[model samples]
Every structure is written in C-alpha cells, then in structure tokens.
Target: MARAPTTADAFNAVAEPRRRDILNYLALAERSVSEIVDALEMEQPSVSKHLRVLKDVGLVDARREGRQMLYRVNALAIRPLWEWTTTFERLWRHQLVKVKENAEKKTNL
Candidate 1:
C-alpha cells in the first residue's frame, strides 16, 4: 500500500479563493508585493494579508530584492495535496465505472 501523503499548512491557505488566485498568478513567475497588488487591482494591505497567510503555509517563498520583497511558488509545499487529490480522482473514476455497468445491466434485464 502507498503511504499517506504529507499534509502541510498549505490546505488552510488555499481555503480562500483569493489566496488560490494568488497562487495561480505566482505560478507564472515571482513578483514583488507591489507588482501583485497592481496586477490584482487590489489594495496593498489586502495583497499583503493574503501573502502573509501564504508565507505562513510554506506554499510560497519570499526574498528581499533591493528594497522590495518578491514571492514565488514553492512547489514542494503542495505535493501532499496533489497526491491525495490524484488518489481521489482515481477513486471517483472507479465508482463511476461501476455505476455505469450497473445501469447497463439493469437496462439489459
């Protein structure tokens, strides 16, 4: 049997839609806080707040670039989510196959 996937604080960070959107945006490339705020057309405080949560969960990494800090996706942090979700996908597919077979049998009867 496969071992359980590692669960990180990332789950909580992704609970909010805004945070998830931030992750998607970051996937393209690292950006400074100001850059994110500008692209999102949201207040600086709001952007910073989301970034704080993401930073706490290890889904993103930040470093000082000049006077500003830039953030980027930390792929390793979400590995567990990917593993568990893929497993769920497989389980759902199997269930659907069985349901279809049962329906076909009933129709044939």
Candidate 2:
C-alpha cells in the first residue's frame, strides 16, 4: 500500500522529521517563512512546503502581517498527538525503573 501524504492527519503530518523540527521552532513564537527557513537551515521552498502540510493538518495557523506571513503552532490541534504519545509514558517510566534497579545492583556487587 502506498503511504499517505503528510497532510493526511496530525500523526502523519508530524511524522516527518523536518516538519517536527518546524513545529518545535514555531512552538516558541510565531515566525515568518524566511525566519523558519533561516532557523532550520532549510531552503525557502522546503520550509514553505512543510508549513503547508502543517497548516493542512490544522497543526499550524498562518496569518498575514503586511506582506509577510507568520506561522504559529496550534496548541489545541496538537493535543491529540500529545495525548496519544503520552499514553506510553507509564510504560517508559516502568522500564526506566527496572534499568535503574539493575544498575544499582551491579554497582553494589
């Protein structure tokens, strides 16, 4: 089966590393296309393309500020992603505790 495009949903949209980076950058503050491009060290077209995918998934909001467009993360839209991933938090903590216990045993040996 062919893989769905990144614009399909929040999960797919954020699956791309570059898109995740873009989201992380935008999380701090709104940024123009050029600003994203420069901060990410990506080409202008590439940054714009990622922004378009992010927008389609509702993970980002874009607004016009004079001739420039500013983009920011849509926190509400990202909640689903956060909720889904955090479901594994407990499992991760359990595993970490096991590892810590084993390390402590070895150090005492």
Candidate 3:
C-alpha cells in the first residue's frame, strides 16, 4: 500500500521523529522558531519544515509575536491521538504488572 502524505492527518504528520520532538517541546509552552532550534539542537530550516507539517495537520498553532512566530501544540487537535493511545492503557498496565511480579519473584529467590 502506498504511504499517506505527512499532511494527511495528525498521525501521519507526527510519525516523523523531529515533528514529535517539536510537539513535545511546544507542549510545555509556546515558543519561537529560534527557541525551538536552540532547545532541540536542530537546524532552523529543519525545525521550520517540521513545524509546517505540524501546522498543516492542525496539531500545531502559530502566531506572530513582534518579529517572531510562536508555535504551540493544539490540545484539541491532539485529543484524538491521546484517546487512541489510551485504548491500549489496559495492555500497558498488564505488562507493567507482569514486570513487577517477575522482579518480586527474582528478589524473593
């Protein structure tokens, strides 16, 4: 099957690692492109490209602040991603329980 374009949806857009990093950074607070580049240790152009993809998918919001454009995560747009992942929460909890049980057993041995 052909791969969907990055702009197809939030999932496709965030599939890229750099875009995920951008989202994580923006989650803390809105920031300028230069700040993202500096904090993430990525080139300005690369950060810009990832930001564009995120914006296209509605996962990010950008606005001008004086001479700089600030970017932030759109929590509403990310809701679907969060909801989808949460469907697997039970599985994750089960795995964690198994790990804890194994560790306790080892300690008791």
- 2 versus 3: better TM-score goes to: 2
* Model 1 / residue 93 / CA error / Å: 1.1
Q: Give candidate 2 regions above 4 Å deviation.
A: none
Candidate 3 local Cα displacement, residue 84, angstroms: 1.0
Against the true structure, candidate 1 has what lDDT? 0.86
Quote each prediction's TM-score: 0.77, 0.91, 0.82
Tens-digit lDDT string for candidate 2 (1-109): 7999888899999889999999999999999999999899999999988899999999999999998999999989989988998999999999999999999999999
Compose the digit string of candidate 3's lDDT tens values, residues 1-109. Answer: 7899999999899789988888899999999999999999999999999899999989989999999999999989989989999999999999999999999999999
C-alpha RMSD in Å of predicted model 3 compared with the true structure: 2.0
Q: Indicate whether candidate 1 or candidate 3 has the larger lDDT.
A: 3
Clash count, predicted structure 1: 0
Superposition error at 28 for model 3 (Å): 1.7
Which digits, one per residue and each the tens of the lDDT, describe model 1 over residues 11-60? 76787888888888999999999988988888899998898888887888
- Tell me the deviation in Å of residue 106 in model 2: 1.1
| Worst 10-residue lDDT window, candidate 1 | 1-10
Q: How close is candidate 3 to the true structure, as a TM-score?
A: 0.82
Better of 1 and 3 by TM-score: 3
Q: Which stretch of 10 consecutive residues in model 2 shows the poorest summed lDDT?
A: 1-10
